[model samples]
Target: MATTNFDCIVVGSGNAGSCAALAAKDSGCSRVLILDKCPPDWVGGNGYFTAGAHRTVHGGLADLLPIVRNVSPGSDLASTIDMDPYTAEDFTGDIMRLGGGRSDPGLVKTLVENSRDAVQWLHDRVRTPFTFSFNRQAYLVDGRQKFWGGMVLSTDNGGKGVIDAHQKALNEAGVEIWFDTPAIEFILEEEAIVGVVARRDGQAVRLAAPAVVLASGGYESSREMRGKYLGPGWERAKVRGTPYNTGDGLALARSVGAKLTGDFAGCHSTCWDFDAAADTGDRLLSNQYTKSGYPLGLMVNSNGLRFVDEGEDFRNYTYAKFGREIMNQPGGCAWQVWDSKTTSWLRDEEYGDGVVRKVWANTLEELAETLAEDGLQDKAQFLDTIHTYNLAVDAFVQQHPTTKWDPAVKDDLSTHSLPLPKSNWALPITSPPFLAVKVTCGITFTFGGLAIDPDTAGVLSEETGKPITGLFCTGELVGGLFYGNYPGGSGLTAGAVFGIKAGREAAKLARRL
Candidate 1:
């Protein structure tokens, strides 16, 4: 086998590994090798699928307080706001609450404190172009309305833009990038990561290094892994992002005594239609709510009954709702119902590359028939449910105003006021065609993986409960840091923060070694 050597070997050139490698080079590491399973064209990993939102305890998070105030001002705004004046402490609390008490509090603190500086470093030192707005929030870019205190992002050139900018900086910093090279396994000795075994050019090569960084991303693409770890129901969910994240690095790390945490991953639930399209190869595209300006309608299970509030954070509730449907409902598929007005609004917004336009039929019966033909739902049951729901909606609308249809407030609207099938029959079942779309839970990225120290970004030992020597992890692999829930814009922020910390700290260790 061919062999090589480096001061540091960073596996997977996505946001975390790329940032780590670049930071290592900047910190004076002489030889840093960054290995990616796919070529640069496919190097984005989950970062590409992101809306490029970055929330911080800095002015950005503070700015959102006003927006929250505008929406619901009467409550204990401070408690609901989840912000503290101490930027670091506030961020730590934010992460801890989101992590559901399983996160490494130390690591959470470190990430929160350094996130702002790390983001700024990427912007100023690396010259990556990012805009701040309400959609973009603090470090976020590409937000639409200014009503919210968010940020915006624009691509530097015609390239994939964000990843390209980071790649350019890495290249300028002289980080050695090996593409189409998958790290098959790690070479560990005496509990320290020594090097990596990779496949490059149809040949196996052993590359020796003092430290190894596993940034290969989470295991969303591996159906087998998901079945084993995320349960059987998850296997049916739609994978909306990179299909290349097969969890190779995690497996390799596990073989070397690394402990796993946060195996329950979360995804953006808005891509529900894509989840149903998994077998058909029809990808679900996002930018729906933001791009289309239409409110997400109610979601019903196989029995044609509404479950949770439609406005719940799409990321947190999508998979949970899916699990509930599979366990409680028949056929294991959910139906999304909307009227002509909502359909027209969404169609004009260009949902899912205009597939929503084609999905919507003229009448409720026709909509059910089309769905049955598409193999998305059962025809007879779906039709019956639609008729029943229409009657309920009509009756409810007659008793209440438009605002009464809101799912956020319950007592404010009577049960009769809720828009059921009876509410308004303007575009009733009598209408030649109605609109229905089959939706399944779609995953964005797996949240759980290896645990790491928040302060140093070092992989923590499961047995000893301490940072592992010469091993660092970042991005999705660092579990417990995010807990069960995610704060908006924290994915990229966490990756950048921990990657920088890991790189700099690893460089310091290398110098001492």
Candidate 2:
């Protein structure tokens, strides 16, 4: 075995790990090394395959002015012209509400309070480019687009943009990044993590460092771990990002007495195109794998039954967990059906040639037949479901007197009586050329991981109920921020926020030790 040494060792090369390494260097750590299991071809981990949206606290356009560039002075700039502002209080409230108050208090507060600062640092220090993502976060309102929810800004070119910026920053900082190197285990000295045994070039090597930051992400890519932690049938869920996030950080930390926390059986999942390859992470097709237009219309299983509330709230509130609902269906699959009235409102992912698996037809009967040909056994039930929903829409409109359904706000249009109901955006399928897209569960990242102190980003030991001396963690590896559900775009924010904290704190610790 070979041995190497560094002041700080950061595992993973995603947004979080890179941010950690950069911060460590900025904090005066002379030697910082980042170990990534992926080769140069697949370096960014899950962050490489994201839209790179970050939910952070901002006063309004004034605060976002520096972060987002190229804002044309017109309402036609997609949906960000009239975007709403979000304060730290708003972000904290969202975390609590979305996580059902189960999120760790300290961790949530750290995320919200430091989000604005972390985002600012990214723009100012890392020089990451950002812009408003109207298609994902905004809705059309009275011909002028409006951004709803707290998340509106994303990397200029999506996840690839973010990774590119981080890699550039790391290079300028002179941080050593070891691609294709995986941290196999931690070297614990008297219960404190001091170094790591890593596998580089197919050989076990020792890397000695006073402090180690683990941002290697979760167990979403491991079929065995998903089956064990996320429960049965999760093995069928499509991997949304890097196949290397196989709980390496979590497993290594837990081996050294770190406590496991967050929703072990839950994860950030979404409606994915069923035709997508099983484990390949295509940077070009990053955003195309998801099918989020289900709120605009209806989703039916093979039995032609609506199982969950399509319009429970906004897509951000429901989209993450809906993939599990699809997986729970009879065949672990569902189809999102939309009429001509709502089809135009869909994002481009649905219509892309190889992006999604879709079926088009002139009428509901034809749509049903097409779905049947695509493996839906109950064609009659499918047609009847559409007819029943349409009739309900007609009755609701006649009695409620809807003038014009505003796309920006949740409309009053709803079903009068149904076993499972659509709570908002209830548009009837009355127009020709209806569309249905086949979808399955797309698991993004596992929610359960190592428990850490929010203030210091230090991993906590379950046995002692105290922080481990030199082990710090961030990214998806740090648990307690999310439980059963999560607000979309908060993951990246949390990762950067804590990663920066971990790096800074670890650097300080290294200097002291």
Candidate 3:
């Protein structure tokens, strides 16, 4: 009913969309507009629930010191410790390795090469605060702090901080953001993108723009889409973010001949609290529902059988794929069992607020009985599995007497001769007071989305194998970067890199148009 005009239109107000709008404005676009389907209060999309962990390429803390503000005294401590530099080669190798060699080489190259610059842009240009990931990465080693895992930086206050900084940047840049406005379809003139038709205040509003960037997130919140793409039991999976991402971006782009790529059946899913709310995850305690320490202990299905090799890789590499494994388990649930030896090392979210479906007992048998009361049917099988696992751990420890355990690195401690052998961080469960936490699937975002040009982030046409003019996409809506699994913290970095690319390129193209 109403018509609005802008130089660039960005869909979604999450990290990518906000960054796209900012980049558009900064790149000489006079009028850049951002539209979010969610209301004002619930804007920012899925990034609002993230920890703001960014997987970036940097040459030690020196490359980061100038950009990161209000940072802890790390350079002084680094004299004794060696902070290894993560290079583009290392970043690309990790992505390809973690994604099972299925990742698009072009997208991987873009992500690795521009990751540090993207983060630096946020710090210098967007005014986003940065801090070291001391909690997840740093650990005392030989009286010095050692940081591993290739993920060393995060937003000052995690996702909330990133969103707030982006919002502030957008406001200062004079970019217009419209909440409760969902882009329903793209406007094309003879197959060239022009604008969008968005539903605003229950009315179809026409927003005319020469360039449009779609950054709305994936279909994680859509049960119907999940059931369709991710298979039958995925409908029961808990959404780990906003309820706004319901495959609309994917559906809209596909309607106009965009090529869908990546693993449609895969997503960045993880083990969340079984009883987590059906519609959304808690922003305050977002990661609490995420069971990431399964590698340090063990996970058993309802049938009391160990179904997966928990220590196959770091949590970052394997967590995304494990949720699907949990879904396939009996009853679509699993128990993350931990003994007192390793229980204390768990992060605050593991036992903090909103942990309701956990049970503690003085003995393994008692724990099994408690599990029985909570719907675990096979008590004997559970005890037997634990017994076999403990024996394996004891045998391994006896061979390697002086075990060096470090949570930051994959240790030499491993279990052999088990059906699902733990490849690292294996320890005996002899310590009393074992605990178990029930977990179900928490779907973050679907990996399947429209294919895009690697350099420009322009959506590609499947038929022509050419970039769609004036049409760009980023964030979870851009496919081929991730496959069956993803390295943790890479999602945000990719979003920022590609968002900036999409915005700058779209602005340049729009100016010409």
Candidate 4:
């Protein structure tokens, strides 16, 4: 066996690990080696899958109040737990409440207090330009604007985008990078992490470092881990991101007594795919369900029945809802039905064109026939549901004079100013070539792994709940922060915040060592 030495060894080159490396270099730490199982091309992990929304309270809570009020309109900002002062006390309280009281309070406090500085450091020192999406423009949380600006993107021009920028900055600052090297296990002496055993080029290499950072993403790519931790149904769900996130880093950390949290926090929802072969390259490439003000649309199980409300936030309990009603159906999938009106609207809408290409159908019967061909469901049951839905639409429209026949009225995407003519606008599926497309539950990121102190960004002992000397963890590896509920783009915000802290702290420790 061969051995290598460095002041610090950071495993997993996603947002956290990359930022940590950059920070360590900036903190005057030399000889830092950042190892990742995947290359820079896929460095973002699930961050690449994100719409790039960020929630932060850089200013005091008072300044953020207006943003929050604007985001969740008609809702009392002060009544929301996140609206409290952005102090360490209030932030920790908010995390515990959002985590259903299961989160480590100490870690949550650190994350909240340090989050603003982290955002500022990334924007000012690291120069990672953040952007906002039009859809999330007004959304706010805890008095801070959710998204700072349009698509807060990195100025680095390349295939890797922000990930590449972080990596490049680390390299320029003298940090070494090892690609295709997977950290298989940790070297523990007297119950303290001292080094790691890694696999590189089909050989095991023991790398010794006083400090280790595990930023290796979650277990979404591993069917075995997903089944064991998430649930049995997740074994069948489509993994939408990097295939390299097999959770080896997480398993190794846990083996060394690191606590795990939020194992159940993962995005589960119906996503369009032209075929099983179409699973590659941007999972939402074929989504036909348009996002207006709401998830205005219809979802039919293989049996051709509306299973759940499309407006239901898929990030929350939508997957669990589908598991109970749609997963075990005829084809283990579902179909989305829309009409020409929706087709035209989607084309004209901002996020519509990309989703419209997913649907297929020439007529009501033809759409059902096409679904049958795709092996998604029984044509007869699907046709029957369409009939029932049509009758309901007609009756509802007749009862309401100013009504329009659109099945997606419930998810009315129309602006608030343009209220629907009727409360229920059920469009008839009588048009020729009715459109339908196959949809499967897709995962965004895996939310489980090594536990760390949210404040110090240090790896904690699972039993004693104290920091492990010379070891730090951040990003998806830091468990218990999110618990079960994800507050939209908080994943990126959390990673950036903790990554900067971990890097600075690790560098300081290495200097003393």
lDDT of each: 0.60, 0.86, 0.86, 0.59
State which candidate, 1 or 4, has the greater lDDT: 1
lDDT of 3 by residue, 328-445 (tens): 9988899999998888777765565456566889988899988998879899999999899989988888888897776667886878777679888888777888889899888999
Better of 1 and 2 by lDDT: 2
Error of model 1, residue 101, in angstroms: 4.0
CA displacement after TM-score superposition, residue 176 of candidate 1 (Å): 1.6
Q: List the residue pairs that clash in candidate 2.
A: none
> Per-residue lDDT tens digits of candidate 1, residues 210-260?
778888888877778777766667677666556778888688877777777
Cα shift from native, residue 74, model 1 (Å) = 31
Model 4 misplaced regions, further than 4 Å: 1-3, 39-41, 58-113, 135-160, 264-294, 313-330, 344-357, 360-362, 384-434
Candidate 4 lDDT, 1-513, residue by residue in tens:
777878788887777787887887788678888888876556656555544444555443344333321234334643432322334454455456545787666666666766667766766665554533323332343454343211222222211345655766776788888888888888887766778888898999999877888777777677788788776676776665567777777778767777665546443333534244322335343112312221334668867676655444322223323432344454557776766655443333223444434556676776776666666556788777667666655665565556433321132322211122212333555665455556656654665667777667887777887888878888777776766544444566788888887888877877887
| Per-model TM values vs. the true structure | 0.76, 0.97, 0.96, 0.75
Alpha carbon deviation, residue 274, candidate 1 (Å)? 3.8
Report residue 463 deviation for candidate 2 (angstroms). 1.1
> Candidate 2, overall lDDT?
0.86
Question: Worst ten-residue run, lDDT, model 2?
Answer: 72-81
